[model samples]
Target: MKFLRTALGSAAVSHPAIDLQTSFTAAAQAAGLIKAGQQFDPFANENNFLLGAFIFEDVGVTAYKGAAPLITNKTYLEAAAGILAVEAYHAGTIRSALFTKGLATPANAISKARDSLDGPTDLDQSISRDGSMVNVTPTDANGIAFSRSPGQVLNVVYLTPKKATKGGFFPAGVNGDVKTSAGR
Candidate 1:
């Protein structure tokens, strides 16, 4: 992120210091996805950790794809495309891991939860199987992955279906001009 910021001629100092676990837990609790006292421990359990990893990776790919047209610089657009490829690879790896563990149900539940936050449209997807064939890649009917706008991305991270300036993964909110989340 800092690399991209610098490449765009912006200072990387906008990246704020945050307690990820605490913010995640707070947002999850607020959204009623987890118990009040529970922490968002990525390694607390295999399926649980994989679910978290899959969500972020999937979102990263979509976010980059959605933002591509907004970027005017050819060099930066190329860089973002490369990053989107890497994020897609990460998402596929995590999806495969979830499928290998036979966690389709739980993974789908997480996907649904993300969908709820993002918008009324059910663009989010999960690992599934069609008899003998495993669906490792989440895509549309055309086999292309879906995209999410910056505001939609913020809605998920903020853990709210309503427009919000702060909550979820970022307790104090993000820096810069894009800080508001989209309403579901």
Candidate 2:
């Protein structure tokens, strides 16, 4: 997870939240997700690395979709655009690779969600009266035992510390009296 340690250069969302970084990291660790480390052999298992790549690519695609709206900074938006394109390429290549390996079924052949290359732009704080699925709803859906709303939230794994760039208590980043890099 060295790349993770470094690539998370800035504090995004605290873990347990469904943001791009945590989702990608968790997907990498999952069984059906990408296998980056050693001991990877395609013939070893029927599902093998091919499936992992597909899942990873799929995760990448949706991750950008999930994250794009939250990003307000122009620089971040530019980076996200690049990431979105890269994800598309990754998915295309992996889809072909999976087909060659006979792992992908015909039904699973390339299809996307309702939102396309462009994502949700206008984010409203409250729900709309039109009864649209895309309308927003804010509530702790977890409070109820059973619910049918998509308002389901992820666990609060970490908290956004006072500072964004430096290590702090919540990210489990560093142990120190001063919230910072040394001598700052």
Please tell me which predicted candidate would have the highest TM-score against the true structure.
Answer: 1
lDDT of 1 by residue, 17-99 (tens): 45568765654554355787778766678876886786688889999989998889897888899889989998888888887
Q: How accurate locally is residue 166 in candidate 1, as Cα lDDT from 0 to 100?
A: 83
The ten-residue window of minimal lDDT in model 2 covers 148-157
What TM-score would each prediction reach against the true structure?
0.86, 0.38
Segments of candidate 2 deviating more than 4 angstroms = 1-47, 106-184
Question: In order, how many clashes per candidate?
Answer: 0, 0
RMSD of each: 2.6, 14.5
Deviation (Å) of 56 in candidate 1? 0.6
Clashes counted in candidate 1 amount to: 0
Measure candidate 1: CA RMSD.
2.6
Q: Name the best candidate (by lDDT).
A: 1
Q: Number of clashing pairs, model 2?
A: 0
Instruction: Write out the backbone clash pairs for model 2.
Output: none
Residue 111 accuracy (lDDT) in model 2: 16
